[model samples]
Target: MNRYLLAGAAAAALALGAGAANAQAKFDVKVGGDAYFEAGYVDQDVDSGLRSTEFRNRMRINIIPSAKADNGLEYGARMRLRANSGASNTRTTDADRAYIFAQGTFGQVRMGVSNSFNDETYVTASMDYLKLGAYDDVTAWINLPSSTAGTVTGNSILNPSIAPDANSTKIVYFSPRMAGLQLGASYTPRNDSSNTDISRSKPTGTLAGTSNGIYQDMVEVGANYNNTFGGVTVKASAGYMWGRAVDDVVGSNYKDLNAWQLGANVGYAGFTLGGSYIDYGKSGQNERTGVFTETTRNWTVGAQYTTGPIVVGANYKNGKDAGSLGTTGDRELQVYEIGVGYTVAPGLTLQAQYDYFDLDNDASAADDKGNVVLVRSILAF
Candidate 1:
């Protein structure tokens, strides 16, 4: 959509509905998204016989609906729609978050599926939003490095207390910010077929844990803290989740997953520097947990400098998979990228980036290395 036309249409809608109910009064509606196109060309030893050109693209739209009142009771929801060329044939409604929340001195409590509590801290050190660009649970453990493997066990349908899904069909609570301290929790019930009536036993894998024949749902709790000392900001976050997994499916025993992360950022003049560390937990049962008991760690250290309308940045990430069930081997991957961006207008920008990655000891097959070039046009208001 044309940026100007989209803005104009939203403004007109607000003008037409200016006198609606006070509680339902419309505020400014912002519309914008971005598209990224990338192409890669690689060369290898002639005898190696490996050559190819890969094209990949993605488009994402982020929408936010917000409202305010004279008394300061605020409410809103955040939405995201994404399209990818790699997964061209797949389509699903991936709701990021939806909640009716209020903000005040006491804090904010949201009633709906939203970001988990443990996922909130490390705002300053987290470059996933701008640096490494990968923000899943594995990456969430950058600093603290817990003992649990970063995998979810069991289905809530089979065992209500152990469901692994994080985003939708759940209720979450977030406490207001107090001296940079934030707390949150979320719960989901077992409302599926596997939970109500199960006839078969689940598989007893090498690392399945106590997930033998359970049939209850689950909950997660987290705490985050951010503080500034001298000139640097420090962040720490942790969370614990326990649930049941049936036999062939997920059993009745309790399986635990824990995650902890720490991050720090320093700014001086036009330069910013930051990094993060994460650790996954181990399974409790000897037979059902060792496959995932190996500790995996991921981290990124990045720096960026912005001046006027231009910004240049680069990042390095190290990913490791240690501790496997079999005698196969360990897996490791390293990624590096450098990019530059320029703002052409208030809501439009252009960016160019180059990325390189290498994977060794891949459990699937041969080793691999590649380079990628990307060009993007972004519109955000």
Candidate 2:
């Protein structure tokens, strides 16, 4: 069946379910979202001598509905829609996320487009109070030179990590917590699903020469534990992802790409500390030889302190061969950041941050340092 049609069918089914819930008066609905704005000044020591001040803003709304069955089973659905300003005075609206889930003592089952086990479970120390803005430090850094073949660009700042495909249809299962431990798993038939249009067709034919379509039959599993010891609370998680090669011209050349991550956090008094490490193994293949030739790894450490309505935090992140794809030369990045967030009122927060990026072996023959200062305001309801 056409995937688009299937998406429509799923939507219809969900609507019908919601209607039935309304008729039975067993439904609960809530609407909430956030409005965010940021202004920042950037300074790059590169040859171009780029120095600029920018302003950006975005808004989103989330609709959530849930119901509980007489047999102690609960079902829920979430849909998020967003509008943001773009370059050249362009604005766009999109359904960022839509998913349905059911849960009970047996555990929980989630279907539709959502985060994978790896993404949902991994722990990190970055202060993401305002994820809509410069949440991570990598954006300030520059990429270095490399020698390996088949270089791919536009890698995520959080490299060596596994994330769900963009709007790819998938199923995820999360086991109920037991003794502070919980497990999760997910499966995706194809990774080329569209986020903006659910009716997009899946890619087919040979993947050898295709610029897109890389993984098939992807599977991910993760586990996390949360517990407190004495005056300190701890949270830790680990995850792994593996997928089968798609449309490989040579079996060996097109090998399965795998990634894993380990993270932990501890909180004591008003202070919290944590770190995470990620490794993406041979995920890139040489475009010429079609052979897997590159790997990426990175780590992050951070600390935060909170008192009253104010929180202050600092973090350091380092990446080796970050986003190098299959290149051979040294590609490295380091980010140091400090920030403070204050609660001005109910559902409103203001934050100020400073970030420094240190780049080495950068592909661009320019200065290796850059800095940014930003102020952000967020209102949620």
Candidate 3:
């Protein structure tokens, strides 16, 4: 059945009575965002040239203009400005998320530079201590070397989902939720292009042995479930992605992208247990002879408890990939973490976490292990 066939009144009713929270909200531009300041201390075996302590902070602002038609058709445009560049680069701000969206009885649609469906809605381990929602920030403290760990492995050990889309220019469709389940999909012409950038030429590999990470014509399909039964809450997500690798040159044979993600969570009385698994099966690897290749994957599981304004949590994450393709084998990263948070006031909180990490290299005996502690203050409005 055609979604447009559905009556606009029905859509308005589904969203709540016409007096809904954002009814015809287009008259005014809305602004909101978050900021965080973090201080970290690391003691690792590989901290030869790295400092034992560092401070980092990030800020973002979201500008959204939205309106609802008399027929209940809602339309909006959003731009998220970010000032996250570290001391390594210029302090210029950039808009990482810029998109336009429309919603009605037919569900919702988003176009422009935006994330894939999976990236926007993948479930994972309970980690309230982490910033916003990131799994690999710990890698920054370790300062792992590239020479020992090879190419296929990513920056973080926990691959929570397929993120190759990287917020490229794309179109996404979301189905109306039914019985606590929602479905979504996205299409990207090229994963490497974002914002105002445009490239009609085919991406081609230039190096002889290195694999091309760029992919074209990417597609993603995903689903999520969120419901409460009695005193227990359940949440889950699954997704798959595929794309064509860059055009190959002589001595280069790049594998197409094939990635998937699965995750779930169970919560009751402020206590939540969750985990996730992600796999990129030789995706974007140079399969030609003399170039090493291996499955890139990661998994994580953990639990957290929240009481009043305080929360505590712990989790384990393991990630592996064919690091440094020319290297003999894969590299592994294991992290055991514990953290706590205290809410000081509305939109403000303090958090601290401790992490024990172990790094194992398949190429040689340059194994490393260490501990990291981070303290952070967050403000959201």
The TM-score leader among the candidates is: 3
Root-mean-square deviation per candidate: 10.9, 5.3, 4.8
Tell me the tens digit of each residue's lDDT in model 1 across 278-354. Answer: 54333222334324334445666778787888888887776664323342454565667677878889766777766
Q: Would you list the clashing residue pairs of candidate 2? A: 144-361, 144-362, 144-363, 147-328, 147-329, 148-327, 148-328
lDDT of 2 at 77: 89
Ranking of candidates on lDDT, top first: 3, 2, 1
Query: How well does candidate 3 match the true structure in TM-score terms?
Result: 0.90
Residue-by-residue lDDT tens digits, candidate 3, 1-381: 122322232344345523344553555589999999999999998766778898989999999988787767677889999996747777878888999877776687788887778888889987887778867788877876554222222325465868776568887777888999999878777877888898888867655645767777777889999999999999999999888887867777788888889999999999999999998888877788777888888999999999999999999999888777787788888999999999999999999999999988875656899999999999999
lDDT of 2 by residue, 198-277 (tens): 43343333444322325666677799998889988889999987765435454334445577889898999989998888
Give the Cα lDDT of each candidate.
0.48, 0.66, 0.80
Q: What lDDT score goes with residue 95 in model 1?
A: 39
Superior by TM-score: candidate 1 or candidate 3: 3
Q: Which residues of candidate 1, in runs, are more than 4 Å off?
A: 1-35, 40-51, 62-66, 69-71, 84-94, 124-166, 188-255, 283-293, 322-327, 362-365
Q: How much does candidate 1 score in TM-score?
A: 0.64
The C-alpha local distance difference test score for the whole of candidate 1 amounts to 0.48
